[model samples]
Target: MSAPTLAPYVFKRPWLRNLLNPLANWYANAAGYRKLGLRADDLISEENAVVAQALKRLPMKENYDRVFRLRRAMQCSITHKLLPKSEWTKPEEDVPYLGPLIAEIEAEAKERAQLDTLTVVKNH
Candidate 1:
């Protein structure tokens, strides 16, 4: 069978919303893969573009948690930079190694959160 054509009303269908929720950002980001680069600029460009596409597609999905996860991902990326893998194990207890991009992500996350809140209010 074909995948259902997406529409705003699709979100009102509980089963459809449940199935699509967790996979929304993941599916978007998984599109267009490329090899990682040794240079920092190349990596940043690739990663940011993937994230931008995922974020752009977020609003079209049928799930709230997908939006929440994306918001949290943006917040975490802003608050925490590329620390060693060991740091991920103790993230809650450890201080994040902040990077220059933190402010931008934080601002974007804040804006998205406000928009989400408004969406929820409208749906009520």
Candidate 2:
């Protein structure tokens, strides 16, 4: 698992967030997944159980689109060419669709573990 980020803590401080906002945007764009027509989440490895389950839960249309984008990115990689600027993934279009589901799954797993380890008490 990746180390927990302090991004929310930084973001909660207005001045820090203001200072970092542009830098974050610049870094995101510079990362170049957008140029390949993929969202940031698309770069996430699918080998994780949670992510794999989230992928299965995606709506058919979103799943198809995800596959299409992945294939397009793969093809671009093979050709060593980026998609045209017009075809690049737009910033507005890069929303997370599966993250919430994965979080929910993880929370459920944690809750299940807590329940499993709980000591039951019977009052006389």
Q: Rate the local accuracy (lDDT) of all candidates.
A: 0.41, 0.89
RMSD of 1: 16.2
Model 2: how far residue 79 lies from native, Å: 1.1
lDDT of 2: 0.89
Candidate 1, run of 10 with poorest lDDT: 32-41
Query: In candidate 1, what are the lDDT values of residues 1-124, reduced to their tens digit?
Result: 1124574676889898888766853543343111110111112332454345434444354225334434444555677644344322221232222222343555677889898888433554
Q: What is the overall TM-score of model 1 with all chains considered together? A: 0.21
Q: Model 1 segments beyond 4 Å from truth?
A: 1-5, 32-124
Best by TM-score: 2
The number of clashing residue pairs in each candidate reads 0, 0
Indicate the worst ten consecutive residues by lDDT in candidate 2: 1-10
Q: Clashes in model 1: which pairs?
A: none
Summed over model 2, clashes come to 0
Write one digit per residue (lDDT tens) for candidate 2, span 1-124.
3338897799789999999888988888999999999998888889999899889989999999999999999999999999999999887898888777788878888999999999988999
